[model samples]
Target: MELTLDDLGVTLSRRRVLDGISVILRPGRVTAILGPNGAGKSTLLRTAAALIAPATGTVRLGDRNVATLDPRERARRIGYLPQNAGVHWNIATSEVVALGRLPHRAPFAAPGQHDLDAVTRAMAATETAHLADRPVNELSGGERARVLLARVLAGEPDWLLADEPLAGLDPRHQFDILDRLQEVARQGRGVAIVLHDLLHAGRVADDVLLLKEGRVLTSGEAAAVMTPDNLRAAFGVEVSVQRNTGGGLVCTPIGRALATA
Candidate 1:
């Protein structure tokens, strides 16, 4: 299913956060939302996930408006991993991960074999199965992040929206997670993530949406939108985008743009 944002607008404390944003996110591909801080990337993801109400326009999943869907159905289809998500409960890590199955089970029903299998796969994919017995709150920041992501993956939703998922991860773990996300997209599911590293974004994302303030600076295939001029325009940095011997893009910021009068 395509996640379509039609003229989305958001406001908080009477301040506009997103305005006139429109994008059609397709399945079977990864789209990276990139910009400097406070560019409405998180808000856009939240709106797409139906966590925040849009002040104007609509977010549609295929032909239906996301607001009109039942909460459980919505949850079953769209799995969201927010940035710095916290697990306040001191529950076992497996228990925390199993919570993703709630939308699929009856009230007060125990987890079936399907649920158990899903949780196991998710934990194993995240390499967090060994930590399953530990209390979730006791894990380090990176461990906790992976555990939370495992919870989302456990749901096996059709559309995955993640905000800055690579933050606080080591380089090895970051590459691992990126590979996992690409695998998810390759399975014909829609995957969108807010990314800060231009090189990583270019490496993983088939498409890129560059935002400045609350509006789109550019949105298209990564090769078309990730040009040096667009990076300078959106981030005020003069960057070099080159392909290495392996044919992957390597984006390096050479210097900050000179201030304009």
Candidate 2:
């Protein structure tokens, strides 16, 4: 499914969090949202997922306004993993992952064999199957993060919105999660990820949205939007963008000396 934010504007406590933000999230591609803290990246993800209603403008999923869709129907269409999402229950990891199927199950109906199968598949994809029997509250930070990601994946949603999904993960787990998300996108699902690491975003994301001070600075292909000028503007640091010998760009911070020079 394709997602389009048409002149999207959001306000909280009379403070404008997002202003006239517009972007197209195409299927089968990964779009990374990169920005400094408080740039409204999380707000954009929440707005896109229909978690919080926009104060103005509209978020459309394939020609249908997200606000008009029923909550359950929307849940089945969009799977969102917020920043540092906590599992409130003491449920086993497998049971927690199975909760993603809630939108598909009947009210008060127990999860059937199919739901178990989906949960198993999601756990395997996230490489968290071994931890499935453990209590969610007992897992380490990274383990818990992967389990939550599996929960989101089990929904089989057409669109995925992840906020700082790589946070708390080691280098290996970070790449593993990104690979899994990329695989999901390859299956024709739209994915929007909020990333703090610009290097990782450049490596995995096909498109990029650079936000600064609650507004969009640029949006387009990663290579186009991740220029040194933009990075300096958004991060207040000098960076050198160099092409790796094997291909792709490597960003190196030049520090304050260059800025003064």
Candidate 3:
């Protein structure tokens, strides 16, 4: 199923956060939302997830309006991992992950074998099986991030939306999460992530959406959209784009772009 945003606009507290934005995010590929601070990357993502209502246009999931979906149905079909997701209660790591299966369970019924298996698979995929018995409140930031991601994965949603999912992760774990996201896309699920790391966005995203001032500055295939000129326009930074031995695009900001009269 494709997640489509058409002429989308969002307003928060009487202020417009996104305007005239549109994109078709496809399944079986990763789409990275790239922008500078206050560019409304997170707002756009939340709008697509139906967590935030759009002031104009629509977010459609394969012809069905996202806002029309039942809450439980929406939770089952779309898994959202917000930036800096917190665990206030001292819940067991395993229990936190199992929460993803709540939409699938019947009212007042216990988890079945399927839920158990999904939780096991998610924890293993995230390398959090070792921390399954630990309290979520006591884990390090990176560990907690992975655990929360596992919680999202356990639901087996058709679309996975994450905002800065790699934040606080070590380089190794960052790579691990990127690989897992690609794997999810390969399994025919749509994946969209908001990323600030230009290099990571170049490497991990099949498509890139560059946002500036709450609008779509440009968007298309990663190779075409991640050019130095586009980065400069969106971020006002001069950057160098190169291909490594693996033919993956690598972006490095070299300096600030010179102002034009």
Candidate 4:
């Protein structure tokens, strides 16, 4: 199922955080949202996932408006990983990951084999299987992030929406997560991530949405939309676009673009 967002606008405490945001996220592809800090990337992703109510427009999951669907049903179709992956309690890692299955369980019922299997698969995919017995609160930032990602994956949702998922991760872990998300898309699940790493977006995202000051600068194929001029326009930084040995696009910021308030 594709995620179709149309003319989405959101206001928080009388501040317009998102305006005229619209994009299509397709299955079998990874769409990365890129922007400067406070560019409303997180707000757009949350609104698309129905975590935030839009002041105007709509978010449709296939042909169904997500806002009109039951909460549990929406949870089953969309898995959202917020910017902060902190778990306040001293909960076991496995138990924390298992939380993804809650939407599928009957009221007060014990988890069935399906739930256990999904949790196991998710933990393994995230390389968190070894930490199953450890308390989540004791893990490092990257470890906890992986565990939280596992929690979202355990649900086997049709769409995965993650905010700043690469933050705090080491280079190796960052590569792992990006590669894993690509594999997820290959499995025909739609994946969208809020990313600041332009190189990673070039490396993994099939599509791109570039935003600036709560407005979309452009959106399209990753390579085409991430031009030096567009990057400079959105980020206020001059950059050089180069090609690596693998023919992958590499973005090197040269300097800040001149502007006066």
Best candidate per TM-score, number?
A: 3
Q: What are the per-residue Cα lDDT tens digits for candidate 1 across 1-261?
A: 999999999998899999999989989999999999999999999999999999999999999999989999999999999999998889999999999999999989999999999999999989999999999989999999999999999999999999999988999999999999999999999999999998899889888989989998889888898889999999999999987785657788898998989
Number of the predicted model whose lDDT against the real structure is largest: 3
* Model 4, total clashes: 0
Q: Candidate 3 — which pairs collide?
A: none
- What's model 3's lDDT at 203? 86
Off by over 4 Å in 1: 245-247
Clashing pairs in 4: none
TM-score of each: 0.97, 0.95, 0.98, 0.95
Residue-wise lDDT of candidate 3 within 1-261, one digit each (tens)? 999999999999999999999899999999999999999999999999999999999999999999999999999999999998998889999999999999999887899999999999999999999999999999999999999999999999999999999999999999999999999999999999999999998889999999999999999899999999999999999999998787678999999999999
Decide which is better by TM-score, 2 or 4: 4
- Over 4 Å off, model 4: 245-247, 258-261
Worst 10 residues of 2 by lDDT: 252-261
Model 2, 83-180: lDDT tens per residue? Answer: 88999989999889999999999999999888888898999999999997899999999999999999999999999999999999999999899999
Score each candidate by Cα lDDT.
0.93, 0.90, 0.96, 0.90
Query: Which RMSD values do the candidates have, in order?
Result: 1.1, 1.8, 0.8, 1.7
User: Candidate 4: what lDDT?
Assistant: 0.90
